[model samples]
Target: MSKSVNRVQKALEDLKLDATIQHMPESTRTAEDAATACKCSVGQIVKSMIFEGAETGKLKLLLVSGKHTVDLEQAAEVFGEPLIRADPKRVRSETGFAIGGVAPLGHLSATDTWMDTALLDHDLVWAAAGAPNAVFSLPPQELKDATASRIFQIG
Candidate 1:
């Protein structure tokens, strides 16, 4: 395995998750790509998105369903204001990975991760694993624990 894949595998292993990181034969940067490769509903693909908090205005990761968009009004009710899409520089500084390749876990810091409650509806979900061409399968709860995320109505 490549060092990048190894790091992601190590992190998932450390969490004791029953998941294996697999390199996609094609680009797996988008949730649609992952869904196509995994042959699952786009809704079953968990997209870990980076956003800037409007309050502290810091960058954070939000794991949402591929089938929907983050309801900003609802997010604001909890977070105090609309969130902004995080830029590339801040994404790398915070998550230690580029935007298109960011994983749901293994960030430089926790950065207030929020897992979309919509994900809990699926028995399994796919997440990017350190690189755009890599992915992994796991139950939603494992991702929540791995990322230290709180469950929220993100969609």
Candidate 2:
């Protein structure tokens, strides 16, 4: 397996998540692409988004529903602070992947991660496996349990 796949596999094992990764030939870098590739609703794809917290000066992860836009104002209002979209350079520097393919956990650095409530509504969801052309489908609760992510409606 490639380095990205290996890392993702290791991450899943380390987290004790008994989920199988379903790799596809097409790129799952974007929500639209992932939805098409996985043959699922757009909302069934987990958007592992990153943001830079100006107040805390740290990286943040917002696992939002694929179909919903990341509402910055709603996020700010709920979190009581502004959440700035991270640049590609910053995201790659922190997460070891480009913007469209960053995963929720297994990041090189510590990031405050929050899973969307919409994800919990789904039986399973698709997430990037470190690369654009890679993906994994697993139970939503399994992901939340494995990642230890906070349940939030921040977006």
Candidate 3:
């Protein structure tokens, strides 16, 4: 297994989650790609976005349904600061993953995470597992609980 895959597996094991990580021969780097690979709807893929808090300069994570987009204005209202997209270097330093495969959990640094309420509509959701070709499936609620993510209504 690659280092990225191992990190994801270790994170799952540490969390006591039984979900298995699957490696795709093709890249599952984007929502469309992952959804197609998993044979699921676009909305069932979790897009983990990382941002930097403009005020605090801290890393923040947003887990949203693949079919949805996060409203930065609404997020600013909730966080009391504008969110800036983290650079690839910053993303990897904090999350242990690159732009195309940032997972919702197992960060190298502590990160504040929020989840889109829309994801709860799905029974099963797929998310990146620390690499472009690695993915994992879990119940939406279980994923939320595992990450201790607060619920937010994303656009």
Q: What TM-score against the true fold does each predicted structure earn?
A: 0.90, 0.91, 0.95
Lowest lDDT block of 10, candidate 1: 1-10
Error of 2 at 153 (Å): 1.8
- Model 2, TM vs. native: 0.91
Top lDDT model: 3
lDDT of each: 0.82, 0.82, 0.89
Tell me which residue pairs clash in candidate 2.
none
Best-to-worst order by TM-score is 3, 2, 1
Candidate 1 residue lDDT tens string, 46-122: 88889898787877688888887876667678666778877899888767888888888777776888888889899
lDDT by residue (tens digit), candidate 3, 1-155: 77777888998999899799998889999899999999999999999999889889988899989999877777788777899888899898778888998999878877898898999999899999988989999999989999999998864
For residue 19, model 3's alpha carbon misses the true position, in angstroms, by 0.5
Model 3: runs farther than 4 Å from truth?
none
Candidates 1 and 3, the one with greater lDDT? 3
Tally clashes: model 2: 0
What is the lDDT for 142 in model 1?
A: 76
lDDT of 2: 0.82
